[model samples]
Target: MSEAATLTRTAQKTEHFDVLIVGAGIAGVGGAYHMAKERPGSSFVVLDVQETFGGTWATHKYPGIRSDSDLYTFGYSFKPWVGAPIATAEEILRYMGEVIDDNDLARHIRYKHKITKASWSSQDNLWTLEAVRTDTGEELRFTTNFLWMCQGYFRHSKGYTPEWPGMADFKGKIVHPQTWPQDLDYKGKKVVVIGSGATAATLVPNIADDCAHVTLLQRSPTYFIPGRNANELADTLRELKIDETWIHEIVRRKIVHDGAAFARRAQEEPEAVTAELLAGVRAFLGDDFDVEKHFTPRYRPWRQRIAFIPGGDLFMGIASGKASVVTDEIDRFTEKGIALKSGETLEADIIVTATGFDLAVLGDIDFSIDGKTLDFGKTVTYRGMMFTGVPNMVWVFGYFRASWTLRADMVAEFVLRLLKHMDEKHVKKVEVALREQDDNMPLLPWIDPENFNPGYLMRGMHLLPKSGDKPEWRHSQDYLAEKEAFPLIDLDDKAFVYK
Candidate 1:
């Protein structure tokens, strides 16, 4: 057969759906549930690169892997989280399993199907997706009327690790938390973890007791909220025999209200918020410890995310003498360990780089529209979910300060509403475009570095889509403001182009 004949045969086997969702993580699973419940007649399928559900939970297997955000908000609003506010990865996966089972979403999900390319055809009013099954290496194709991108913002294949001099000369085994080896043993070994972020905080404590001695090396300090993981409102509600669903909703509201207030206070009175956060850490590490040097951050509270240390476990590990903290800049790696710029060399048998992750722009999938390669950086975001010139597609980029699921749930509702509106109008295509007023609006980077500049986001800001001055044109990342504004969004607004 000719090459064209083979291509024609493959195209003939392509499956089609009303909607196609990427990533089977929390956001993807929630998207599926909403489509099933609200748009029961619409045919949709979810594709994930991982072999199972729980995107991050399934990918990360490092020790002490758990949620930094409280589960009440991280979990789907439709489902009640019955466990502790901070849950282990295993527990989270189990909860996700229950959701899949309860909703009968298993049949709709295709695991190990990694989407490699997405092309939008204006003539056909459809999206053609090419995927490969990771397990069997089988090629697959699908077409859909709408595309729902739930793949997270970070690269899951590997974590980021900076190249240090003498790394090849060092005899010790170097590991990254994202790809933890299952058979590697750490018992009685001297371990050093690099980075001051949440990953380092979680790993040092969990491995302290087993290691001969563990040290946390950092270039700068970060803010943390050390507190008990228990939620008092949920406990009281349970004692009073309240329904689990009611408890979930009530506690979720309280937390959201408190979070909004906290965010406001952080902006209005940054000094006070910083002092209070430092005080929380001081209480955990005790007055004698060098909290100023080790715990005090240079930036204001909530500038970057303040990780919650459940039960103050990370601090407890430091206080117990099993672990120690070293705040210094690394000059380079030595034969034995890392050499600090201060002329001090710390020895370690094993080193773990908990630096961070690389941000993934639109699942790193090759995307093209109308035979032209789409440059996302050239488009302005529409409420951070949709892009200008992008039709019949929605991407779920969640909150940084609040639980990610909160925005996921909101976006699900918005997408459903848009779909229904399109049906009513008998339109086959819908896209966002700049209105006359937006022509002179100033375009800026996706996010302001001063507001929330994490390493991953800062490094990848150039690759992200731009934002406009108008509220409708920017992502905002403010859940409180979006909560009120999203519901009032007029589908027939001037910016919306329908055909």
Candidate 2:
């Protein structure tokens, strides 16, 4: 074919839609559903790098992969979660699938389309995206009026694994929890899980029942709360023959309130809350175990995420001698096991790094506005959704302290409201532009560093957008504050610029 024919064929591959959502995970699915319902005929497509729906759910395949928060808050608002409060990865995936099926969102999803770059053109009022097909290695292009980034905050390609000394010399199998090897058997093999985050908490109990022994080795200590996996109130309401909707609403309120109260207590009276939490750990493990040394955290409560082990499973495993905790730094990795800084050694057949995830803003998608590349750290966040001077784009950033879906649903609702207002006003472009006075306000981290000090968040703080002292410029982690502010937020506020 001639050069002109080749160019024509290439142009044919580029598709255009009213909106392009850069994920098909829970947030993406919820965003798509809300868009379809609120906008009616507005065309949109949800693209995911993975071949299936359920972003985190589909990606994480490690043993004991489950919800850190209760399903009442974690699950979408439109859907009612009738399962255990702490749901398994498969259950969460099934829930996501149900939501997609209910909304007919599968028809609008293009799987395995990994977005590489998205460039916004102010002149054309459009975003042009370049993506590569994971399976075929085919390049593709797309254009949209709006770009919704629900790709999540963490890097999906790999989990965070620290480089330990003599890693290459270790003859035993080493693995990261993010990418679990399916065929590897550890039925009678001793395993050492590194890190004391939520992933470690989940893995210890789940793997303990099968492994010869499971040891959780952490540099320091992390706060953990043991709670029931099922909601007793919901069960009571069900037995009373109450409507499912009512049950869902009641349970959701209770969970949210409980979560809020815990956060409040953690921030206001951290020492007291810390003591109470540690006391619970002592009760589970008995007076003989050194709860204060192994369970007590150096940081204040709510400063980092507190791992919740439903029904005290981790403690049970430890109590039953199936699992153990080692609070010490790794000196090095020997062929037999890991040498500790305290002159101790742990014998293990396998090492599982539950170290956590690598944070990525907008899935680290390359973004440019017109001809200029965007610097997120320099730009301020607009209500935790859009960035300053960024037009027709929304980023789904959830609450670090609460369930992720809670903030996701709120953002979706806010996005829909913005779209509706734009439609009513006949505006093609909408951007969050700070006023002169707003610019004078102190620019802080996306979340107050004091309120949230998660390792992943702290590590990637420079890559994320900033926040200001002003309400419009700040991203509030308080669910109640956002719950009231989002629906009642004035579109006519001086913060937003429309054309």
Q: For this target, which candidate reaches the highest TM-score against the unseen true structure?
A: 1
* TM-score (all chains, Cα) for each model: 0.98, 0.98
> In model 2, what is the error at residue 429, expressed in angstroms?
0.9
Task: Give the alpha carbon lDDT tens digit for every residue of 1-499 in model 2.
Answer: 9999999998899999998998888899999889878887899999999989889898898888998888988988888889999999999999888888887888999999989999999999999999999999999999999988899989988999989898888889999988999987999999999999999999899889899999999988999889778789999999999988888888999888888898999889988999899988988999999988899888999899887789999999999999999999999999899999999999999999999899988788888999899887888888889888899998998888888889999998888888888889999899988887775788888887777888898888888888888787888888988898888888998888999
Relative to the true structure, how large is the alpha-carbon lDDT of every model? 0.94, 0.90
Reference-based TM-score, model 2: 0.98
Per-residue lDDT tens digits of candidate 1, residues 146-205?
999999999999999999988998889999999999887999999999999889999999
Note the residue pairs that clash in candidate 2. none
Candidate 1: what lDDT? 0.94
Best by lDDT: 1
